[model samples]
Target: MKVHFILHSFNASCMDHNTLKFCVFLILVGLLVNISFAKNDFENCKRVVKVWADSSLDKEIGEDNHKLRDLLFFLHIPRTGGRTYFQCFLKKLYPGYLECPRSYDKLRFDPRKKKCRLLVTHDDYSMISKLPRQRTSVVTILRDPIDRVFSTYEFSIEVAARFLVHPNLTSVTQMTKRLRSKTKGISTLDIWPWKYLVPWMREDLFARRDARYSRGLNTTESNDSYDMEDFAMPLKEYINHPASGDIVHNGATFQVAGLTNNSYIAEAHEVRHCVQKYKILGKFVLQVAKKRLDDMLYVGLTEDHRESATMFANVVGAQVISQLNAANSSLDIGDKIEQRSFPDSDPHSSEHQNSTSDRGASKVTSSESGETAELNITVGELMNSYEGCISNLRTSYSGRRIASLKRISPVNFSREARLQVSEEVLQEIRSLNDLDIELYEYARAIFYRQHKTTLQTFTEERWNNIPSIVYGITLWKVLPLAITCVFLLFLFLVIVNVRRRTLKIKMKVMKS
Candidate 1:
């Protein structure tokens, strides 16, 4: 019909008023078409691009359902209680050979290079492409964005203060080696972010040093705790520093989306340019990061330590239950759930020693063999296992461990750091990290859903997976309908004008 209208209009007199009106009408229609095409396909997709994972297709559990995935990837975002979580949970689950080496500065953690069952790193989501696509489950924990910013800044200063104290250590490698040698093995310093982050921070922040900052260090206070107050940085000055930009910006969003500093998907920036910059970037990042978070089997939270630990046990660690069942045929579903932990005779050792041994055909072993035996907690035995190495995460991570560490760690000073920031500055931090804030909210939603419905049978999980209120419409879908409406309106106007012209021409001929 559009073709017929165009042909009919063109077939009219070249010099006629009807022809001129038709030309103007065509120009207007073309402009509308151009405007529609000029906008990004993602702009309309903004809120409308729904993020839901479906698995209802396979109703029954297959034979392979009991087997573990190829890899368990811990997408560790810094300053999110990741260290404590890794120590308490993940480090216990996979024995040393099965676990990837601790990687902070190194980004390339392909299992092929160094074979391991689990990969834990501070690298962003972009590392997903280099990994084996099949059956690689990812997990991460999130912190409140404002608190995370504060923690990051304070931690950087703490690390820098330590670096300044040891003036002989010129590089992270030297420092890592020194700590490793002093501790006689893999120490906290060996794997911590200070390995790569501290040297640069010392160079950047500590241009001029004062003795008062480190003077009180190593002194036993009234309670016998190390004085860490002198290490704190002013929040406002830290926020303004160029070095702090990556730490304070929408860090969680960028890290989760693989759009962090010096590296980003060009498409995301392009989409931002074509739409409302802040709004569109936040939505684009939230959608992508939310999808990644959904892909993970479990997500922990810094604040909700106990709940996160419980969820991690049920969701990500369920395979351990299956492995235990396979290892011992006499074991019932409700039997004791204990697996082997490596290199730690004492389950709750702070040293948490690792092995450099070859991969074991079997993951769990008997305590008689000298390996650290972890009581694998079955669903029925979860409450009791809360006292063990990993499950102790429920207890230790909740309040006990952090509180104990506060006596010596910088956490004791974090309250003072937070108190220094005014309400306005805190709000400014929120504004800067709006995407991370949104991402964290979505993380909370995923966390809730994992606990609520993820444990159900596959069909039920799929059936309930669709969020009733979250069906997003892509602007891509809206554009076609908009174009159709514009075309119909233009057609109506053209027809009305053509009819008026026909009547006027007939009347003139009749008078002649």
Candidate 2:
């Protein structure tokens, strides 16, 4: 009897241990299954959000009656398609209010002209704060920082080349001349014919060197004599220089955060704080940014310029016309031709003739008549000479001729060239623009969330239009729950069957 009791106790102990082990295993399996289901559910949610967003976007294709009472302030970040936005869309849409000032001090709002609806500027964060919050609606476009920096460099080079080859005018002197001309009273830079071509006139011009140095230096030079103490030296040496403090480092972040001068360093924490005022909350919260972003009238993206332009038109209560396309077509060839022909068409024009005598008089001592004629060469011929200079520089610096500017697409050249950058150099760029990278990521996240929220609202608004059966079932919300409940029931049944089988075996042994 004693032996049987001890054996029974031991068997019971073993059974309890086995049951506990099985329970633990089941618990682990349940946890894993739940995690997997949760992951899948999250992905499904994202897909639903995307679908809803797309549907909402489709509805907004030709939307109307979007005019608002507030003044639109477009914060134009350099090299981020400001030219395209202003030239192709905004200028036509708001001709009365297209004010592009070089600096914050120069930006003037006419209290008398309440129709002043728009102000586009390269002025940084502080400018927005100065405006009446109730009346001002800020809108801006952002780009990949690395790409923006490269584009800035290339654009600076091109503008410098145009300046050097034609008349070798300093940006300040040229601006002074313009200010002295009849166009002096004009508030906006766009009034000038060369408005789009003279981005170098801005005080915050990113390029530090002349066109020759910018185009001629080899960035990858292994020369031992060259100094590498300054970060910007490499950029001056090579066209493909990686990101550094001297270049347009954290340019997007600085611009968005309202830091005007490049002298300011981009500290991540400080930037987060600075942008917080514009954000929904005064803390580092992405949700705040998302909310604020949704409140904006329009946020354009350069990559999606056409669609953005349409959206912009809708917001301003303007008719989307074929003028933009026509304008772009004309700009592509017309502007270049005009710029080249301007000097030649009227070599004896008062503007050139007056300046030529003062500057060319000294250089003309060798051959007076020949020098004067040479100075009167058409822009095309001048550009050819410039190209020859660039070619020679390229050969001297890199031991090979670089691609002609005409062959490269201005918008896409930097993007395509960046892929060819070495991994080490790429890493250096990433490190230099860490704050920009963070800010960009944050902005993107907020943008997506805003997009999702917009879609969700649209979806809810259109809920009644959905078929009764689909609406009644609320399939998107109910399907997952239904599947989960069914799975749990199946699992419960299996557990009950296993328990019953174990109990029956124990009873049979006891009975025997």
Candidate 3:
């Protein structure tokens, strides 16, 4: 009986051991399952960790339903935050879902049509509207107009000077003059390529006289053929054709076209245009685009005015939500954006510059690979990504400006530059030396003319109407002249008094 009890006791001990081992095995299996699920469910997009990635963090923040995959109609301005949004946020998060092709064609993310998900491009609002309902969500970023303008101008100057073999686009003066020959140097003028491109490409605007095939033609001959149904229109007629001008002016609002010449007119015209274009269907969208446009379309933007941009993004709804959420959450993503960035000095670094402007496929492959690994970023890299997005959105359409300035690299300014830049500006301005037209008036007129307004109109309205200093001197020129005259008068008085005293002293000595 005692032996029987001992065997039973041993059996009981074995049973307990087996029970413990089973529990341990189950726990291990559970952990592996959880890890696998985490890997599949959570995605690192735009180098930004989403709010839903960590359950504990999500619980703390009270964020739910984080996987509301949105349709993004990203209004990507060249240097704006679009690239960062695409590279770091959208690509990884959506994977094959987001339709942002690395090209100049507007992306369409059609889930059902797996042919091509992302459409890479440099298209405007009209194209953005074509995106599918479920696959596309629209959002855009804007910069302060003044800063945007300057950046666009600088970047255009940089790019043209760097990669493209530009002919006659030598200096800022030459750029302005060349642009003026076709269209004024308006604010939105930088966005229109046909004006400068057709001339620069030297593709005889008279080459193709096919109207039916003129959908995207940038020349008059192409349009004339369509209208005439025959190519009998004079070359000069075709050259100065409205269709050619329309190619430059189409899609651009009147204000954008007129901005370089008239702020008031440009603003008024653009505001009116926004009202007319979006009045039928895109009321909310137009309002958002216009509100954002006001910030970048008129003058330009500076770096400090970035907050206004954030707020601007918020008004556009769902698309902005992802951008904003990504921006806010990425603060903890390690050092992505650093102050001492090597990318700043080396424009060749894909991290800071967009590769779409010049070098083609090889450059794109290298560039994509560089930023592809940004999913594991530090805070510095995230910030850099954010700034890069803003830069791209602003400068995307201004490729000529990019080509002109060589924004990515330092260009050698040799007299051997290809563009045929002229020496003089105009005949009237050069002949105005005799009027001593208030230098202010002359300056204002010059600026106004560039903005697309006539000098006579600007002078009559603003400067000419001002009470002239009867001596016809501008305050800028007059102030210096007045100071000189006062000094000369004082010197003459001092010299005459000294001479009289000396003469009196000599006479007294003679009498003595």
Across residues 300-323, which tens digit of lDDT does each residue of candidate 1 receive? 788887778776666666675565
| Candidate 2 local lDDT, 1-512, one digit each (tens) | 43345445555755777676655555565566667765675555444434433443342213221234346777667767665454434433432212323222233333443334456666554454455656566677767766765565554444433332233346556665766574423322332211432343232222433432567742423322112211122333332332234236666655554443432223423433333223222223233233334455556565654444444544432322232223324544434343223221111222101111222111112132221111123223323333344355335423211232322112223345556556666566666666566666665555455455555755786785678757577677998999999999999999999999999999999999
RMSD of 1: 28.9
Q: Which has the higher TM-score value, candidate number 1 or candidate number 2?
A: 1
Candidate ranking under TM-score, highest first, comes to 1, 2, 3
Error of 1 at 15 (Å): 56
Q: What's each prediction's TM-score?
A: 0.56, 0.43, 0.29
Candidate 3, after superposition: displacement of residue 48 in Å?
45
- The backbone clash count of each candidate, in order, is 9, 2, 94
Between candidates 1 and 3, the lDDT winner:
1
Q: Which tens-of-lDDT digit does each residue in 3-37 have in candidate 3?
A: 34544554565577767655555556556666665
